[model samples]
Target chain A: MSDLTAPGFPGEAVRLRARTGAAAAFPPAAEYGQVLFGAQCGTPGDQLDAMRLVPPVFMPQRLAKLIDLGREPLYQDVELGTVIGGFSSPLPVYVSALGSTRAAGGDLGLALSRQAGALGIPMVIGENVVPVNGYGRLDEDAGRSLLGRLRAYTEHLGDGPDGGVAVQQSTEDADAEVWNLVYSDPAARPLLDSGRLAFELKVGQGAKPGLGGMTVVDAEAAARMAGQYGLDPVFGEGRVLRSSSPGTFTAEILRQQIRLMRNNFPKARVWVKLIPGRDVAEAVRVAVEAGADAVTVDGAEGGTGWAPSAFTGQVGLPLAECLRRIGEKPPCLLVSGRIWEGGRAVKSLALGATAVGLGRAALLAVAEDQQDGLIRFVECLSMEMRLIVSALGKYAPGEISPDDVWSP
Target chain B: MIEDGPTQPGDPRAHLSSPATRSTLRIQNQLLAAAREYLTSAGFTEMLPPVIGPVTDPGGRGSKQVDIDFYGHRYKLMTSAILYKQASLLAFDKIFCIAPNVRLEPLETANTSRHLAEFHQLDVEVAGASREQIIQLVEDLVVHMVQRTIAALPEEFAALGRDVDAFADLVQGMFARTTHAEAVADLHAVGHDQSADAEIDWAGEALLSSKSSRPFFVTDYPKGSRGFYDRESRTEAGVLRNFDLIAPEGFGELCSGSERTNDYAEIITRMRETGENPQKYRWYLELVKEGIPASAGFGIGVERLTRYVAGLDAVWQANAFPKLPGVVSP
Candidate 1:
């Protein structure tokens, strides 16, 4: 094994170890057991590369833009600004949902929030944080509670923050009243006032489509909740397997849930996160018809948390196919999977996606520089997006048509 | 064998041997007799409850069903007699059972007085009945049971510190009916978060129960939060024809009933929608295909009912061989 693959870095040995007891030539190593977190983690991006975007040599969109901007060959005034889930954003990009995994929650969560705030793009705080961590004034400087992520997201944001924070609730988080607490908190008053707050009903995620949320907890916590949740003590000693219900959903059920969200929390925007299920297109249509402001599709590639090995590649439809199935007429479609660079983001935007979510890419970008990592990473992506969109002769993300793409 | 105060925690036999346990058991016997007398007079046949089945209710509330090796095949311990209740309709139009159930409830729920790993339910079903009719029957049955206990065991009530007059309103058949939407709105108004799509969660149920002074019905839950057996409302889209009779003053839910979805194709579709393997329900599906009666039924938590009537602090006090969730007991 090479030195880079030895332990701390991403290399061939790591990939082999990830595939585990298989062979030298194998799939890339992911969360099956590696602890080294960065952008280069988890399973492959669910083959999003199946769809390609064609950059035309002609420039009609540029001429139309010239009419709009009242100028010439200058695609400089391209409007990247757009609305996502009822909130204004400078670009059609948002941070994908982040669960309370050890690698992502707490400080890293705050970092993601601060950077997302800086970029003025929306962020989704995933489930189990409140039940695992206390809902308090986290610290003098950093509050790590549900409100803490909100505060961090808003703190670094300059005047007139464009994007918002969407609090996503799983069955467990629902039990703990994650959204209720956030919606009523004085801390979120500013966000609500700015019309930049949303509550995402977690129907499914890309990692484990039909499965519930799973985590490894110690014996004490397990014993405390032994009567309320299922705990498989497979790890022995202190460790045990704890799981939450996956939540059941049918077509009528999806429609009714959205209506309920609208009725109960009338002040906030409603969003629904969907996994790439077998009926991805239908689910998207159901969500849209039910009046969802945004329907996020977590592609099979973007689960950054710990999940069982069986689900990573074997389960759920890929992101590209999900987008393709949702087809040309998009409904505030937000897509995510191994999307850090602008090329992939642009490709997603062209293939009937209203926006792209940054999952591992956002986390790793922060891990890359801590202070300027995410900003620099986003800047690089923005640069690529401008260059690519300009090449397509379209400035705004909405201008990217299905005619600009090929699907397989 | 009636002994002293504040019984031991783990072994229930010690508690059962106590005077408090004796009184509780006496009241419990009256409750059973009262239930049987009412059901039998109301033209219902009582049967011995089944211990295992080919498949059980997919209690999606995180509770698990125990599976045993039935020779080479797998059989599950009955979580509730719901499926069998529907099947039993073939033999008698109205059937009832004092059935035992086992649920591997989540560990954390051990604290809630509402949950238990092992318990009994007064399961009732009636063919060609509407959800409204069953809910009325539940109210009548509960009133009859409470009145029977009050008349037969006045001393038990006095000893347990419950006023018999507290049940007067029930005897008069006066109860409030709250829809799922109204209940959710109430919860939100009181600063609680309840999913409008799902059932009123445990805390929300307790809050609503605590606020009420008398037994009330929370009805018409949205589809998908319950088992596939609960029939969806044909007239009202996305709503189920079901109701949960919540015990007043924070005792939580005492009984849940719904109009059964009897159509075979619909049942299959529902099973798939609920993510259950359709092949596992071979026996029940075959019965459905052969046309089980259209029924509406409910399982009243016997211990919970007794706890509410006796004014006991916890449900375990109502059962001799009480099994608290996650607790090892006799």
Candidate 2:
């Protein structure tokens, strides 16, 4: 091993193991592979900004929503609606997973899927978007493929029932099976007959947790991913990199890959995600005891496009210590990292998550306005999550729990 | 009900001299002469199909698939000659066609009064049949095309006033069935949560066809909600021996058969488990690997059965050059 040395580490790992000789065991952007990683200017130590939502001096669900709305209930009566991974989201925020890199793939991922489907929430769409954009072809022009961000998120997700999309996939989208082509797409049958679809799975993404997914391209897209991914030319002869792999699960192969994605995409909605590892709460208790329907996680201050700026400020664990090691009844739980405003999404919904995602702050609010900057940055994070859930006297966002947070 | 007809780029034959398009084309020619007198008196064999293909029917519901450029090889067009009614059941094992499909659909199903984007189907099949014999031959072909279009057009269903007692419980005997987990638990007992693994949502099939008054079906479904040519129900491990039918007072679905996947290694593992690309079904899996029979088909639509027997409130007023979906016309 290049003269192994373990004399009490750090000296910036011994002057980066003497300027990365033998690429000092990966990272340091494996010796600069045609760079791209963005957003990184100090902002790491997390634990949901050392918590604190704490309100209760007497609130009994705002006195049962002020005697069931016979009066006093403002903060727009809270209810930033929810249901994420099973869709119906009008709020508890979503948008996360933005893959195929080059700063949030194609048309800024269809203008963040047409303003997160006209602000109804839920988005995802990450991983190598159908092996780099092309699971489209319904006689062409479904640009930015993955059925053009599922037809710009179900044609501006109008006919209510909140929003939804999900997608994800990875491991080179299971050799382009990308959830069996978005579960047998007919442009994903109106989001699988209106359950608004979902699929997710991925396994590890916060910046670069346990690696896989690297992007960089251009050697004519790494010679069209010559023999499917893991390209490398050490990002040189006209920039290449590519890569993918990080797949290899265990908890019974992640419970038989969520029972073969519920016996092969039984009308989608499965989810999963995970990464801020250190057994991110036993992989969210084995993907919600193998049935998933939303799990996410991310954390290591998530945000990527091409990592190794020391796995974007030191790899994994942070979205408030993966929601304090996924505690407090995490069933749907989501969470992300560097979440944009609404005080870290109502302090990751007062610490038991169930929502908060908006990754790289929804690609920097649709790169600052691609038709209403992520709808006025989610209408200023849904009016700062209804004035922080009606100033913690709560009215909805599932009545903000963990005794409305407060850590040391 | 059959009113629409004015495209004025110089009124191309103003809806063929309307009188409500001549009583909706005389009740769609006795609903295509009672579907060719009930599939040639039940023996079948009609055929005409192939309106350009190399592959069509990639299982719709969201539609899109017009393509053409044929001489240069990109074909397509017929969005439902359901694989040429399963390769014309190997030249004959009971067939039927009336095909002509186009499909670009979704423009939010152009105001959903039953979409069109150019249509027509009636498409049957048979060979060795059985998904309970094509759901009893599509409920005796929709009660022999509504008793032969009400005895050869009762004055075009009384000049389209239509209401032959809405086919009293569908010409009596057998029409109501359900199972797609009891129409998704009767659309989650009226709250309409539908999706018992999908295929029911045009507003939950118009809320289970406006709580049915006749004509039903629904059946199995679930194996990833269709099109690896349906099949997959060897004693139900995810169901799907197919079905749909619908059409009651709400006038929705009107047929969508199944029980197909004719073996060639389960049609190449149901075309790679429904993501298709079995090399774009090379000549229909080389004629289902040199064989093609195990049928049990269905198609229906024909302007949604002439807009539910000419009671026409939409399906483009039961056609005559309808098209609709994203509009634009000739």
Clashing pairs in 2: A170-A173
Model 1 Cα interface RMS deviation (Å): 9.9
Q: How well is candidate 1 docked (DockQ)?
A: 0.03
Evaluated on CA atoms against the true complex, candidate 2 attains a DockQ of: 0.04
Query: Which lDDT tens digits does candidate 1 get at residues B14-61?
Result: 776766667778888998899999999999999888999877876645
Best by DockQ: 2
lDDT of 2 by residue, B142-210 (tens): 788778778766776776677688788887748877788877787888787655655677788877787
TM-score of chain B of 2: 0.34
Model 1 segments beyond 4 Å from truth? A1-250, A253-282, A285-342, A345-408, B1-8, B189-191
Report the poorest 10 consecutive residues by lDDT, candidate 1 chain A: A1-10
Residue A64 CA displacement from its true place in model 2, Å: 25
Q: lDDT per model, in order?
A: 0.76, 0.73
Q: What are the TM values for chain B, all candidates?
A: 0.95, 0.34
Quality class of the docking in candidate 1, CAPRI style: incorrect
- Candidate 2 lDDT, tens digit per residue, A236-298? 769878777786665655654564566455566889888898888887887787678889887
